[model samples]
Target: MSFQSLQLAPELDQALATLQFSVPTPIQQQSIPLVLEGHDLLATAQTGTGKTAAFMLPILHRLLKEPEHNGKVRALVLAPTRELAQQVAANSEAYAQYTGLKVACIYGGANISPQEKALKAGVDVVVATPGRLLDHLLKGTLKLDKVSHLVFDEADRMLDMGFIGEIKRIMRHLPEQRQTLLFSATLDEQVQKLAAQWLAKPQRVGVDPENSAAEKVEQLFYAVDDDRKRELMSHLIGKNNWQQVLIFTRTKNMADEYAKELNKDGLPTLAIHGDKSQGARDKALAQFKSGKTRVLVATDVAARGIDIVDLNYVINAQLPFVAEDYIHRIGRTGRAGKAGMALSLVSIDEQWLLEELEVLLDERLTPQWLQGYEPDLTKVPKDNRKNSAKARKQRDKKHILGKRDQRRRKK
Candidate 1:
């Protein structure tokens, strides 16, 4: 159904039409009506399912009818990362432009002075990262006492990034009586607990099955030795003629090293990580998104902020320790109903990570043996590597130990 059927205001309809968004995404289709009806919502959908607009539209509609008073924050959107906060702010601005709604963004890594100035000027909507917003609260620069609508975009990621404490702290500041919406790609037990604590009889809406990747993405894994991973990557990129590739490494140093190696091989490559200045990260991201650079190597932190359309491939140079991250990594490709590919080079050391990822996906990844890149069977695999079946058992062992340690620490 079209966005108009959701009973949005005429200005919002015009905004959607002007932006050429004629058809609503599945998440938007399911969640918009419930949000418009003034109910708290917990929605689970993949990253690129237009989940941002689902809540944004309804919030915009509410704001349009309400009067904006000085020092009153009507809507507050808490994002996990600076990039996400900026993105939400941009979306808010785009959707609210027609109604002349004022939007302000607050996040770390920029001048606090400017953000403080904006908050004092009184914006109708504030898109902020939890930590930075808390900073404003402590400094008496921002107030959430008047906030009537709240959104925790990327709720799972916020928890992963250790923002749970900040999120709970923010809750204390917000009026107990308000509309709360928590959206995530997946809702784990922790997220569920938060939902129980925060949302009031919320409507639970999930457009797709939990932790399912897009059908358009062709996922493949290559078995290669740790030493030969870089070689395999260069060969695959050359053989496949991949124009735009997003490569994920486990660490910042690895990202930089791989990018340098790829550049030396005549492929224009760049790396984005926490070590680099924000200016450098932004520049590299722009080049990669514009397709001016053929390869962009990034650590997990860098991956969260960079969004490119029609990205052809995502290469996992080093698998993530967290299983959910595997889903988000491949998600960078296959966005906006587009076909894409996710290729992973798994060394002997990362077999356990691989197994956990497979369990999370509920499907084993098909191993494709590339010619000349086959793993050596003669050598005993390192301690870090275990066969897929063994890996699951190992993970369980660790979990048991972790629980024991928690109890001991408490005692």
Candidate 2:
């Protein structure tokens, strides 16, 4: 359905039209109306499902219709990472262009003076990371008394990053009577507890199954030696002529090292991790998005919240410890109804991680063996001392292959 059918303000309609947003995404169609009605909501949706706009459009409408209050933060959106906060702020600005909504993003990294000045000027909407936002609130620089809407975008991610305490602190400061909306890809036990505590009879909305990956993404895995994984990655990128590839590593050191190796192969590559300054991270993201950089290697934690819609490929150089992270890693591509591909380089040592990932996605990844780099089929996969029943259950439930020795011995 068209965005105009939502009965948005005239200015919001004009902004949507000028932005070429002809149709509303499914999440938007369901969420915009509820948010505009000022109800607390808990929305579970997968990544790349236009979840960002689900909250942005309604918040913009609310800010525009209400009269301006001086030096008061009317709307607050808390994201888990700096990149997510900036992305949310950018989307908020794009949709609120015609509404004269003053939106600003505050996060750690770079100078805080500018964010301080913006907060002092009375922003209608403020998107922020929890740590930095708490810093401002503690310093008595940001006033949230007037905030009628509070959003925890990526609530699951915040819990993963160990931000529960900070989020609780922020909740204490917010007015007791206000609308709270929580959006996440998955609502695990911890997330459910938070929702129970924060939301008051939240309207439940589910667009996609929890922890589901985008259907447009074609997933594959390559079985290779640990040392030869980079070679395979270089060959895959060059062989397929894949541009705008996002390569994920489990550690910061690996991200930096792999980027260098890919660069040596004549592929324009850069790395983003916690070690790099915010400026470097931003520059790397810009280059990757503009197609100037063909490959971007990043640690899973650092790249967790990146929002780049035109990414053509995703390569998991190393799998994450948490199976859920595998979903978000490949989600960088195949966004907004665009088809994309994800290639994961796996070695015998990483077999357990691969197994865990498969369990989360509920499907076995097809392993494409390269001609020259065939894996040693004789090597026994690592079971890591002893296998627990929980791990085996995860494997059986998801139909993950391999680890026959452990399963056979258990029987």
Task: Report lDDT per candidate.
Answer: 0.83, 0.84
lDDT of 1 by residue, 1-411 (tens): 888788899999999988999999888988899988889999988777788899999999988887777657899999888877877888889998898888999998888999999888878899998888999999999889889999989888888788888888888898998999999877777678889999999999997777777778899899889888888889889987989999999899899899889998889999988788767877888888788999999988777855676897999998887777787888888888888999999877777777766666766666678888899978677665334555476455543211212222333
Put down candidate 2 lDDT per residue, 1-411, tens digits, no spaces.
Answer: 788889998888888888888898888888989999998999988777888788888887888778778858889999998888888888889888888788999999879999999888778889999999999999998988888889999888888788999998998888988888999887677778889999999998978777777778888888898889899899988998988889999888999899999999999999999999999999998888888988999987678667777787999888776767777888888888898898888888777666666666676666778899999888876665343345647768764333322343453
Worst 10 residues of 1 by lDDT: 399-408
Query: Cα deviation in Å at residue 153, candidate 1?
Result: 0.9
| Model 2 stretches astray by more than 4 angstroms | 378-389, 397-411
Candidate 2 CA-lDDT value: 0.84
Worst 10 residues of 2 by lDDT: 399-408
Clashing pairs in 1: none
C-alpha RMSD between model 1 and the true structure: 3.3
